[model samples]
Target: MHKINVHLLGHMSQCETQESSHDSKSKDFRQSDSYSVNETNHTKAPISSTGGTNNKTVPQTSEQETEKRIIRRSPWIDTSSSESNSIHHVVPIKTSDTCPKENTEESIIADLPLPDLPPEPPTELSDSFKELPPINYGQSNSSLGGIGDCNAYNAINSKKRSLEDNETEIKVSRDTWNTKNMRSLEPPRSKKRIHLIAAVKAVKSIKPIRTTLRYDEAITYNKDIKEKEKYIEAYHKEVNQLLKMKTWDTDKYYDRKEIDPKRVINSMFIFNRKRDGTHKARFVARGDIQHPDTYDSGMQSNTVHHYALMTSLSLALDNNYYITQLDISSAYLYADIKEELYIRPPPHLGMNDKLIRLKKSLYGLKQSGANWYETIKSYLIKQCGMEEVRGWSCVFKNSQVTICLFVDDMVLFSKNLNSNKRIIDKLKMQYDTKIINLGESDEEIQYDILGLEIKYQRGKYMKLGMENSLTEKIPKLNVPLNPKGRKLSAPGQPGLYIDQQELELEEDDYKMKVHEMQKLIGLASYVGYKFRFDLLYYINTLAQHILFPSKQVLDMTYELIQFIWNTRDKQLIWHKSKPVKPTNKLVVISDASYGNQPYYKSQIGNIYLLNGKVIGGKSTKASLTCTSTTEAEIHAISESVPLLNNLSYLIQELDKKPITKGLLTDSKSTISIIISNNEEKFRNRFFGTKAMRLRDEVSGNHLHVCYIETKKNIADVMTKPLPIKTFKLLTNKWIH
Candidate 1:
């Protein structure tokens, strides 16, 4: 038995010496051999069972049994033998009896017979392997198992390769293998990690708060000392202005029983920074809390429509009319309020517990705008001898001049500067009016009204833009690194389409994100609706996702905002291409993109032009789904009729002549459906009613439906995402 144990030990020692010699030849050989062993754990290989060179497949031992065999070996034994052996006899050593006092690899190797040494190694092999660091087998318990455990073998090989110059070779192999089985090998990522990565990559910089501050926030905010003082001073100025205007009856204190506390409502100061670097504090009542029964709902004030403003500007530019802008100071204060209302003064005003009765229409009252509108309407029509246009109540005109009023801001168009001055003098006499722009001649007119910058070159062109609108709202963000580790220098340009997906966010976080997204979209919507028609479609598309915005939606919105900020200088210019006559026709270009929205709803786009100048347009989602492109086109035409009718009425009222209205569409089928008189031909279609109404308009000569090629339709930009070239062509070249 002793001789048999010695023989087995000698065999193991010989195998270990041969493996050590082979490993010393090349580091590449060690890596390849370790990989082969790992592969052979689950596959057939051409390794002999006796650890000799052989080309035969052997049945491998189970990994569990192999691990047990390795654990049972002596600590100093070489467990990295490439061959598997089964023990027939047991020779257990007791610590107190057969075991040596010192258990070490040198002692074990000395007990066994010495095997014949190999020939001297080559100089290249000696130099390459000599400097290779030895593996630290004592670092972990699992390392004792050595090559018996394929995982341990690979780990050790990885450690050794990391210390060597062949790291690139090992990395290449690992990357290749990982690429083939990446999905299986990758561990599941936590939701937090995913969100963190997305947030880090999405925004380049934080957007600064540019919104108005509430009264409390304004007073308490001390970040900027100058700004804080300005806010306080502005508040004082607002209080003084209200007192001078006698907005409320401060002389008499109203008892709580006299008026319902709810009806009395609350008031606060809204602080804002104006464009010219002046701080403005507006004292507004809490009109939102006012009961509906407190005021007449039917008396709601109407502001001038965008279409009317554009039409008037187009007319003024075409006819070389003198243009000027007027700003009414405390215009709402001049109007009386029929309803008895009360409001609390700001805390700092020292009117503790005393409620002031409202005598005039104060800003923030529900009916303030309507009351102011009526006052101005009465003064312009009865006092100034100007007649209100038939359709637009905010627009007043006479034989010599036309006036467009939006809230407190007003635009006057006159045949001469004297006529404009006459109206301005009358306005200044009745109410405090500031002339924002007084055009001295017909050659040039520049002014800003309702945030729109208007530049009119008489008989040449009228350009309308909302400059600094986006730049002032959106802030610079940090650009994220791409996969290649490079920063993107150019501004992001998003398409008109949004692909929404379910986002991974907690309910509260999601709601907060959604609120932020809505505010951003609101800013975009204002610019898109006012003059930047090129962004209308994109804004509409993004607005649809506000209910369930995700990281992708936020990122895309930032991109859209960035694009708008970069291209804010571009304006909507109306070139004078033809003479303006009383009989000139109102042209309408309509388009639709079918099944583009979620739930198969279509997109409707329309452009209203008068004498080759754009007056107004709309880009919105269809209310109902349309099954076909022709149906979508018909839907767009039907939807645009109301606006078109209003525009035509305003133009005819201005010109004092019956004007012809024409509808241009890219779809011949839609035109055919509108012009078709056969009732049975469209009986199967559900749009028969709309088609018949349109046909009546056509037959009655109120509208002329004509076919325009798709490429020539400027409204195409409003329906779908177009190539940048086509978008520029339609918006910059064709529209102008």
Candidate 2:
């Protein structure tokens, strides 16, 4: 047993460490000789016999038993030899580095290069040798590789040189016999015979079911559904009129290319961001007929051009009244087509399909705009009994309420005297319109009003927001890394470049960092909280660790989500209410991330409040160009005007009025721009024009834009990430 253990261990160690020995080889030789002696174990079943022992000892057998007894008593010694049966101990292999050549050969042969065996078969058959009946077979196991070898290996490794030489002789003889057999069995082909066979098969085939037409007789079909018939006839007559006039082509055809049918439709509805707080739908044609520079022809001349028009319409309506917006179901379908147009039907429709003669205005046609405008005008003026307002084609009125129209979009105000049902009934009778009632579903529709995201909120009809969306609907305005012309150097080394090109890559990186910081601080400020400067830096570091590559945007979004989750339990509330005074008015505090280039645009930070409720706020970059602090403030003021106006309308819409409105700018010159209104002009025409417009609008509504001392304004939180003391002060005023 000790020898066996040493042998197994030595086998494994020899393979691993290359140890060799002579005694191990001798032992292997002895084991192999034992395998040859066991032919019965390979070829036959075992033979069994029973015997009983004597009272004192085991019973002795006859000649066969005596020989077995001698074999058992002296297993290693040859029983045929006359030598005495002396037991010789089996010695263990030498544990030395240098092994004898004989031992090495025996050891290697014992560790045979055999392929791995499949799972073990039934083991009931004994491995020991015994006697059994013999049967003769041609494919003997010993003649082959060994017992249990797969036949597939013989086929793969066969080396029969004579088989390749007879290949051509076999093919010629086989082909000649096959040709003779085919000629004897088959008939010759003929054109007449083939045609006769095909005709018989065709006659025996099953026929498809025939379909009956629903409108074989137009007069009878019309009688069956009178209203539908009337509509069809009216449409046909309208189409005939359009056929007599002149129009452009509007039909689309695809040969074999893939197309997104919905994308083509949606693109038409999401063109520009407008100010009107209404359900708006915009469209732009393919303009494939024009050059790239001439694509302006695709613009719809009749759609509401700006948000100011929408706001003005809202302002003209009464306070006690509710404004309801109605969208025309297929608005273009109702417009009378006063032009002749032809459209080749779609590819799959049919080659011989007749073109659809235009009955109503459709997209992509030149005459469609004028026809739609004229149709809407006639309907509102003649059919609806609306009084057309002078100098405004879209604005219309009856004695009870005013209807403001921008092409197909109309806002109907229900005056204090008239009930809501009356206005709805009147509009329904004239045209097909869908009323978008607030709070219908949880899904939100986002649109930009003063560049703030307005979503439908409960208690009030809508709420204004300043948070960036997890996803943007329009492709993000590809914010350039650095747009200004300033030369930026790498980090750690001021004048060095990241690579040989000296791309100013580090400055681009810094610009992004500053932008991210600005956004974070903006959120804190907008919500009336002051983030710790170190906390901001720590957050930035955490951001770095999480986002070493292009994942920074995603990391920032996650951190923001975390921030929102952590702070969700509380909201900003004033600890104490100050008395109503001229100096204690709501103020907009301003700051900027300056001395940084090439993103040298000014940052606009603002917060507006009424009755201590922070009604509207924002922290963002100014879109307009500016060279100085005064210009920056003027730009910020222009950027903030629409928000302030929206807030005022919201207050009025909700019926809350405040005593005074003020704009807080640190720069006195910006205050001068506000105070002068139009009297003083600046070098940059952008500020002067926008400032005058803001002044005129504010003054017309009796609101004021004043510059307070910087310490008093709560909007300072927007400029940059602040230290603990200043952050706390700003947050304390806006948030309790």
Candidate 3:
């Protein structure tokens, strides 16, 4: 039998009683081999079963036999051999770091399903190898005195290379397990040692918290360290702003009872530069957003040129009026959060294991802006005696002044300086105010906003004047290609760029490319909508290809860019265009080309004129398909009536009475059919429903339906592609 030092702490009495009975016989034993003496008198596994017993003991009862376990060896390190076991180590499984430290051996072992043991195990032992006792895998290294100090752990895991062949487990002689040499288990230094099963390395040794960066990013004017300093400064600045806003009460939520980890939202500081050449750091909360089930509402940017024309008209109407733009600082924070929400403290802010409950709306949150707008809307409509413009809640006015809310941007109009003071003071009490720009031009018109310049060619007549620096971005194109022939997902045309190698298209990368193309298409569309109305048709056709643009489609986009560059000199001409008649009102020319799209739908064209100049126009698809030119034109007319009525209402809101306007159309047949007294012509139910809506607008809004020659119609340029001569004549005579 081998000499085994048993660090027995909790179960000493059972082993001592069994060994005292076997001590009378003499036995031979080795010195170095370690083994376990069973504390319970159950299925006892001898260290070397071939060794003979000095005395033949009586068999134990079935209950003790059934309860017998523990393979007479330490579960953490190999002890059956003089050297380390080259085979598997009998150790408990490792667990996640987040596992609680207070778990017991039984608690930990209960989770592991009993693994299937192989049956061919009698080569080394005869029915003696015992079952393993449960070992807690969560034990700390400090609690277990150097379990990894074993030779197996110290070695380079090179047991295979060191041996010429695989080591086999060998049976020993009968004298190896002489029963007289077996001693009783001794009491350990502490009771805790026996319960401590498997000791893994400490949590600190597993993962380290990284404080410094591994690499630095390059910047133009600042070094990596300097940029980091700026970022830290910006981070602190944002923290201060949040503190000032009373966004969260940290002291209240610091209690663990009040804040649950599952309920806590996450927040972080975001850094960016502004369009006005300034740095800004904003803190945002990542609250789990529930789907909005309330009434739909939105914020809108008041058109700059439209506002400019209105401001000029205001000046023309009353020279004493003043125009200015104002903004609210941290507008989103003014509204309180209506739901129960909590935000975790930002990492690296040193907030000690705490989360913050959100009290106010936060920037970059999904629905914060909408809530803030609602909050402000309530204040303006209820408290300020202001009425929203027809079809536009963003533009609010009373008898004193007009207030336009473009998110944070506000353009205020007043009759005098005192009125402007009252308006500013009233808004200042409700919000943190910043005056972006304020002035009134008595002589030469000075129009400047949105980094865009405006050229006043004549009285109240203006054009968008882009800066030389801005135009420098667009290279001059003498010969631009037309984009009429390309299709979006057309199959297998030879591309300038190959896709097999050097240009493999990953799905994600392809989607990103398509998104970039879509953004460019949007930029082109906006420019067309605001200034270059001539390019509207071209942009709409290209926009249809945004989802699955092929190489040819991309080529078409490049051609459109070049074409825009070629006609960059063309500008949006905004001026007062109402005729000098007894009843001053608008004249809208509307038309439609049926089946102009691939979807068998019509393209709508609308042109509204006021004070003998172009005020508003659109080249877009009709909302519904129309089988006839008359239905198409009528749909086109239905779309324009709302816009014309809105314009007339704006003028009327300015204390000017706008009477009935003329809606001119080139389709005389369509005009004659609508004016007919026969209601039977419109009784197709669905068609009749749409026709009745049109009929109601024609009579209800007091609009005159007139017809003109197709050649003379100003809206004809938008319906289809025209010859260069006719397009030039139209541009020179009317559109320009």
* Worst window of 10 by summed lDDT in candidate 1: 1-10
Q: After superposition, how far is residue 69 of candidate 2 from its true place, in Å?
A: 99
The candidate that achieves the highest TM-score relative to the unseen native structure = 1
Model 1 accuracy (lDDT, Cα): 0.59
Mind giving the per-residue lDDT tens digits that candidate 3 earns over 1-736?
1122232122211122122111101010111112222212224433321111112222343565545521221112111221121111111112222323243222222211112222222222223222323233322221000110112111321121122211111111112212323433554322111111111001011122111221122122346576666666766777787788898766675655675455455665556544443456677765344233321235332333454344334333332456676778888889887766667676666665666777887875555777887888788787777787776557677887777676777766676646666777778888889877664554444445443354442334555544441254443211222324322111111111111111223444445545655555755665666555555665665565554344544555555665555455555555533333333445677767654443345677887665444555688767686654556777888889887887777656754543445676655445544565455655357766777788777777766665443434556556544333334444553334
Instruction: Give each model a TM-score.
Output: 0.68, 0.37, 0.58
Which candidate tops lDDT? Answer: 1
Task: Select the stronger candidate by lDDT from 1 and 3.
Answer: 1
In angstroms, how far off is 605's CA in candidate 2?
5.0
Order by lDDT, highest first: 1, 3, 2
Model 1 vs truth, CA RMSD: 29.2
**lDDT for each residue of candidate 1 in 437-552, tens digit (9 for 90 to 100):** 88775566667778887787777877787766545555522211132332221122212123222245544455556566667777777787788776787777666556545555
Clashing pairs in 1: 204-477, 204-478, 205-477, 205-478
Q: List the residue pairs that clash in candidate 2.
A: 20-99, 21-99, 25-103, 245-340, 268-283, 275-307
Q: How large is the C-alpha RMSD of every model relative to the true structure?
A: 29.2, 38.2, 36.9
